[model samples]
Target: MNKVEMHHTIMAAKARKEMTWDHLSELVRKAPVWLASVCYGMNSASPDVAARICEVLELGEDVAIAMTEFPVKSWEKTVPQDPLIYRLYEVVGVYGPTLKDVIQEKFGDGIMSAIDFSMHVEKIEDPKGDRVLLTLNGKFLPYRSW
Candidate 1:
């Protein structure tokens, strides 16, 4: 599958795993909202964030390495860009809702902002086949009313 398709496939699979924002967030002492943002592809992962995410997901180091290869800049010119990068935009725009729904259901009104977040994607070989491991870490900011 192409990047966009691959992105969706990954998301759908993760969603099916029934992973909640709190479950993943609690793994790394990050905010559910921030983690959600990374999952939905609205933000990029920094190195420190990636390491923390790996720690929480128990995904190990290999996959964590690929994940840090993020922050890809696709568009930054006076004109359009390649079709590959374009797919990323589409994937994010469309799947964003799905990610948000899952996060809200798990964390209530809070959100996983990318302001302080990180991610890591790696491939691991299992008996069945190779699996892609993803880890995300963000600051856990509990929402409150003043």
Candidate 2:
């Protein structure tokens, strides 16, 4: 089966077994976000990790191999229509430049590396409503003049 098919299988098994990414990651000994991305077909998994996923999901070797294949990280070209995603898009559009300038000023000319990133989602309790907090942590990559 193809990578897309593998992803479908993973999702189906996850639903059938009522498994969470955090649980799967614990079993596979990997970070939840990274493991979730692998299941979503956005990232590649090591052979051992892929095999473990297959075992857990009751998928076959095809899926394990597919998990190991390099992925092309692509998304829709236009702005997202979903409200939550669109709000993120709006935040980036509004504050991206300011963030960049502040970062550059503070840390010199460089960029945060998504390749070396980690993120966590947290829930904060408030009298009004619970708030979703997303924290992104990434390594800083400095520009080098050749």
Candidate 3:
């Protein structure tokens, strides 16, 4: 199965099982965000992790194999339309330069490594309304002078 097929199959199975990412994370001992990313085909899983995911989801070998394959990691060039996603894009668009300046000031001339990154999502309860908290942690790779 290809990534699209695997994603569909996994999502179907998950819905049928009435399973949440947090539940799956508890079962598989992985972060819910990371596991969800793997399921969404944005990231690849190791062979063992793929097998574990398939086993928990009661999926077949094809899905497991597909999960282990590397992802293309491409997205549409246009701005995202989904409200939440679009807001995130908007935040970056508004604060991208500010963030760049602050990060550069602290870390020097370099970039954050998405390849070596971890993200976490948290819900903060409040009387007014719940708030979403996202933490993005990445290694700072300074540019090397050649």
RMSD of every prediction:
13.9, 1.3, 0.7
In model 2, which runs have C-alpha deviations exceeding 4 angstroms? none
Best by TM-score: 3
Error of 3 at 18 (Å): 0.7
The residue ranges of model 1 lying beyond 4 angstroms of the native Cα positions read 1-80, 124-133
Give Cα distance to truth, residue 109, candidate 2, Å. Answer: 0.9
The clash tally of candidate 2 reads 0
In the range 1-146, model 2's lDDT, one tens digit per residue, is 66799889899999999998888888888888789989989999989999999898888999999999999998888999999989999999999999999989989999999999998777899999999998989899999999
lDDT of 3 by residue, 14-36 (tens): 99999999999999999999999
The lDDT for every candidate, in the order shown, is 0.60, 0.91, 0.96
Query: Which parts of model 3 have CA positions greater than 4 angstroms off?
Result: none
* Deviation (Å) of 141 in candidate 3: 0.6
Better candidate by lDDT, 1 or 2: 2
TM-score of each: 0.37, 0.92, 0.98
